[model samples]
Target: MTNFTLSDLESIVATRAAASRDESYTARLKEKGVAHVAKKLGEESVETIIALVSEDEERVISESADMLYHLLVALHLKNIPVASVLTELARRTSMTGLAEKASRTPQASGGRQED
Candidate 1:
């Protein structure tokens, strides 16, 4: 089986984003701007949460894929590389979760940590 990775998806998104909007959904989404792509990412996050709570494995997998795709698109819109995210994840792994949480400054909303 082919091992498809996030790097592969990132490359695909980059390529598709260059296409004419009429020919590619990724291109069209990029045209709509970052806020719109952020909205789509939020929608996918909700769907993923619902699927997770429902205990539907297939649905969870599907929604998670959508969420990741939307997330990558949103990152691309802002010129953030997936490698940068992965690097943060790697850095977080060097510490205990609680320690990592403690290291972060508390935001007004109590700082959401996705690590």
Candidate 2:
């Protein structure tokens, strides 16, 4: 099996995002900006959830790939590196799930939750 990783995907995303929009779907999608990328991400997320609920392993895998690709695109648009996300995940792993959840400060409004 190939030892591909998120880091590898991130590299690919970076490259494709820089290509001419006429030649690359990633560039085309990125040209549409954050709101559109986010919408695509949401759609992929729903599809992934549906695949998971139906218990079709192949569909779940495929949809998950789609979801993650969209997520990377969104992150790229925001100038956030995948390593930052990996670092946050690693930090969360140091604490129990309950502890991590409890440690988060509740937002005052409908603000984004802190990671």
Candidate 3:
């Protein structure tokens, strides 16, 4: 038996994502399907941003944790790994922020304004 590690939260997220519905919140989120998971992520992100704008470090940290947790759940729902996101981030790390912003078109996913 290879006893490596669930040392990383990504591993934890993966396991939780794959487990039976009763076994974990992340798993439950997966069972509920993509739209539900996406809604939860959106809610958490909004909470985190609200905390940030209020300049409350404690709430910011707390909500940010919730945000990341739900994001992992969303990723699991979509079969996308955290590393994929991190890799894209790594690829963009050297690019000028303004240039990156300009490089993105308004029609990209998540860029549409609410009705």
Over the stretch 80-99, how does candidate 2's per-residue lDDT look in tens digits? 99999999989888999888
The lDDT per prediction is: 0.92, 0.92, 0.78
User: In model 2, which runs have C-alpha deviations exceeding 4 angstroms?
Assistant: 108-115
Which portions of model 3 show Cα errors greater than 4 Å? 1-7, 105-115
Instruction: Give the per-residue lDDT digits (tens) of candidate 1, residues 1-115.
Output: 6799999999999999999998999999999999999999999999999999986899999999999999999999899999999999898889997877777776832777554
Candidate 2 weakest ten by summed lDDT = 106-115
Model 2 vs. true fold: TM: 0.91
Q: Write the per-residue lDDT of candidate 3 for residues 1-114, one digit (tens) a residue.
A: 756432366789888777888878887877788899889889999998889898679889899888888877777667788778888887777798666666667785368643
Clashing pairs in 2: none
- For every model shown, what is its TM-score relative to the native structure? 0.90, 0.91, 0.77
Question: Each prediction's Cα RMSD?
Answer: 2.5, 2.8, 5.4
